[model samples]
Target: MTKPKLSTPAPVIEKVAIANRGEVAVRIVRACQELGLTSLLLHSEADRSSLAYRLADETLCIGPAEVGASYLNIEATIQGALSGGADALHPGFGFLSENADFAEACAQAGLVFVGPSPESLRLFGDKISAKDLVEKAGGPVIPGYQGQDQSLRTLLEKVEEIGYPVMVKAAAGGGGRGLKVIHRMDQAVEAIEAAQREGLSAFGSAQVFLEKYLAEAKHIEVQIFADHLGRVQHLFERECSIQRRHQKIIEEALSPSLSPTLREEITQVAVKIAEQAGYRGAGTIEFLLAPDNQFYFLEMNTRLQVEHPVTEMVLGVDLVKAQLLTAMGRSLNWQEAFHPRGHSIECRIYAEDPYRGGMPSTGVLGFCHWPQGPGRRFEVGFEKGDEITSYYDSMLAKVIVWDENRPRAIEKMKATLRDCVIFGLRTNIPFLLAMMEHPEFLSGQMTTGFVDKYFSRPLKEPSLTRSDRQLAEAVVKTLNREGLGGPRPRGPDGEAGPVPSPWGHSWRSGL
Candidate 1:
């Protein structure tokens, strides 16, 4: 492989254009300002007044609400970058972050893409190809087929050879969009056809691959950073076993279930895979740990992950800063071997209706509130009056908590979720609350299918505990005593009628 020619490291990036919107776009902007770089934002016509657009140093309208014409349009993003005089492009997580074509386009235009090289992305973005590369690097991979013919007859033969209950996954898919579970030969044909259709529509790639499915598996991933100097380091592991329909709902660091020796073994394999791919910048190596203690390589994500904050909280490192410095050809300053000190958990709060098959919720937000206090951190995108639309992802915020142990962290998260509120749109708050209260979750007996099995019950209206109810009553009484600047007025029935308080309006309404 030919090495990239290093040009006298472009004047330390005075300005950067975030190529996506929402919470991640805001996140990149804050990171840029910390490094003394001006932040630029690219928005669609519908998001002209978004909070992120207002916070940016400058904003450019890319196109209409259709993602094809706006967020996913590589040419428009590049034009926006050049017109805004941006020296670098931060493809925040989704959309163009993992797109090799987009990354190469940025490089060819002389704009720095804040991620691994396009070659590395291409090598790992395709599941079939990535499996071969991992095996070459001495990593264990599930036995499966990577061929294209996928005819029903051929697939059945392969399934017979690999054993029953295999997973049919889109080669170019992520976020669990195009995956299906097949348990017997009779179901293989229909599963493959449906997956192919979804993959074609969603990703414009109909390629699918087969893999041996492990039941009740734990999903763990290692965070690795590689610099331009051929050095790589691992930042330990994150357990993302709590998922629903292939999407992660909660993630934690220093997996409560893994032994110390097992953790080290996984980290070493992750480092080896990174070195084999000639990887640079921040990337995640995912693995599925079976009940028997054996682990198989899942796919590699060649960009900064949404759950990266949990790792940062426990390791006391800024992964975004490291990515920026690595893009500028700087080596990591920390030691090669780092250990996590405490436990950290992150819960994703989305504007969606969990009761209605998790359909995305869209409306104008009337009130926005985030949790606070010790061990709580909220990364949000929308404020009051912001519109939640179906044009983009449903995620509105990520609430993370850190503590000295898993149980404490779990409790902190439960309280934080209760304190957060978003009015005027249906949210998954009730579902999140239920998950936190599950016995299996608290005991750390979680798996990728935990949500599917335990989340069968429909969410009911949340009830306040006795102490919370008492606090609410006291707050209501105080408000009645001080009614809107005048002496408290009694109703005809002799009861305080609809006492108003700025702080307890929603609480009193039981919303």
Candidate 2:
């Protein structure tokens, strides 16, 4: 079938309704404003006063905090778009961006989905189907069985054929959910049954597949953009090897471990897969780079990725704008993909206690102080007085840093973390600091299991020496006297406080 042509009819996108909340919603609103599009915001009852809601050109209250009636309720969100007279709907990363039903419904309602086609979503939404496309495109596929008719007996036979220690994954699930590892052939039935049940409950798709599990593999993904005019180009790769429980913690561009030849080969394969899938807009082709340098196709994300900023910083391109232009039927302006210049690092700041198994912490944000300097980008969802609820993901902000080299980027990230402060809830700042200080992390010897192996222990409490405590007390006294209009007091050195004590500016402290 010939692909339908996307025609740019003088920028028909007049207004856009963001069908989500938090940082991603704010990011979309910023993009819409940059393109001279009127930005509309939709919020739940719980998020009536969110920062994004205040920043939008128009705001609509959709439903209650229950996502089923708010974010995930396709009919309500569509009605919101229609009521607001929005020309298009931008489904940010998490809520319903990859939902084929949601995408189709938006199209049927005469509003652009601002993402890939529903056909592409459905095709790549299923792991087995995506694997078939990858194999046809000459991309390396993990040895496994994609057959559906195979019973328990036949599944065992296939497992034996594919060798032991395989992964049983839900065909419809992503984000490390609905996956089980089977070490031997005997465990296949249990693993498959569990995966099927989870997949059905989570994604409403019971289909599952098996693949050979790599022991020591690095998670890498190529960011690709395709316009409706059949123009596709890759913006290099991001090393997401640092993960915990299959969730990324830190992401960087231009992996330190990959050679030039390996990088080119993997990027080419990513483009080939996109061509085979007839993909459009921004998408990421994920892979598992093995210890022997052989990489196998993992899956394709049919929406904007959370780690897209790292790619943008290194390549000096705005992926969000690219998505908008592609959706509007404009071909890419650049004839060639630009080489990634410098190194970029992204740290996901979550409102959770990493020391306590990363349990989600919910409360009002009393204070928030982000670091500001050159090459620092902060993508945040909440502000002071905003509540960090337990209804959604615990991510509070994304701290990204860029530098000319990887080591300098790491140092810059460390400095950024040190300057950040969040109060009223436990955060993962200290946990991220511990990871960055590790010798292995600095040496770039990280893997997917890096967090599991290195960060399993609780972070040590920061120690303060006698002089440090004295200095803290002196600063508190000074702040109380000058800032809060209290009586001035003696300094830590047992002398009257100097007009400008040369101790540098007082560091703001809260969380």
Candidate 3:
């Protein structure tokens, strides 16, 4: 890796502490390695055997498996970094990534936080403040109420004024927590209460806001990066309309829905908002593109997003590396303009049963294979023999592929999904494939409500024939007797599975 030219004398950042888990942790570890920095993993007890734990230069057990005691514990993270002799801390994506208090704690502890400043986090952490910033920056905003009135009567009155089909969202929430769409007056109170409860539980704040819900809107976002000199650059936009429960599953760079004129306008608006907020490092400005092509500001994410790989693939830049350089007060040497080369698509592979309404599948992984080829990039967190527990997000990996066009990219992704393999647990591959084949998806006309509109139920499976069941039973018996080519069969489902072996158990067998 070529060292980026420095814009100013930098405080030496020799070591970095990763304060998250799963694939994002693996990503940070690799970035640290490429930058020739020592990587210390501050992990919970449950993640001791994770792949990131083995890849990092050092490891420290911060607390137990529970998030509040481990990943979300700000003081514990700071102390772990200090004890590990880390010069900086990288809170990847979730947990404390967007917590202003955590960032301030890192600064107070004399550790550089590899993200935007604490002030920036605070500005965007609350949805109300973020919306105000957008409005002050002249960015278009949806018609809604952001007042301080907390009474039910005031809220209900405000809801009536905003009309039916309003969106109730947590002021300090993301990733679909504390967000609800109230379709009618009868459902408004219940949805509001639910959003408040979720907000309090997930983000520690029950303050809620309302927005006019655009039922057919497309979810789009622009990526922005700012340097120490306050130079902000927009990295185009991504389409994240195909979502479930307001959380994105598939994201692609260079949205198919935007025209050149609209794209220019939206990206410029994003830059203006970031500049107005004094944002630094990596951030995202999300928006909703209505059917009439009018765009409105949604909210801002004050950290590196999970879907950043698609942007990296299209623009041919490493955002994580740029982030590190920015933290060190270095210039990115970015060009005056960036043109996306090709279409890139990323599918979030989750450990869930697609036929069971995306039920979480937890167990020891076995015989995992991610096919390698041109334009194929995989960020995986677990390997064979690692357990996939329910303590955290169920996403197992992110599969990204690039091609000259969207259609070709979609085809390549389908072929790639078909060639890939995983054992001992069900995955959402089938569901993703189904989504890829949908006409609306193929046409790139999917909206934010696509999943809820078309796939409200579990995928239906083909009825099994008697002969098929008999064959499956025979295979299971053979495997049971052979003991997976060992002296004794491995114990229960997740406790002891095949190790250092090529065998796999099929979930379709129903044994």
Report the number of the highest-TM-score candidate: 3
lDDT, residue 39, candidate 3? 95
**Please, what are the lDDT tens digits per residue for candidate 3 over residues 437-508?**
999999999999899999989999766766765666566556656555322333333255444344555333
Q: Candidate order by TM-score, highest to lowest?
A: 3, 1, 2
lDDT of 3 at 83: 99
Per-candidate Cα RMSD to the true structure, in Å, reads 5.0, 6.1, 5.7
State the number of backbone clashes in model 3: 0
> Candidate 1 lDDT, tens digit per residue, 422-490?
899888887888898999889988888788787865665545566765676666566555452222344
Give the winner by lDDT: 3
Per-candidate TM-score against the hidden true structure: 0.88, 0.87, 0.91
Better of 2 and 3 by lDDT: 3
lDDT tens digits, residues 240-347, model 2? 988875678899998888899999999999999998888888999999999899899999999999999999898888888888877666765865759778899999
What ranges in model 2 sit over 4 Å off? Answer: 1-11, 149-164, 182-198, 460-511
User: What lDDT would candidate 3 get against the real structure?
Assistant: 0.90
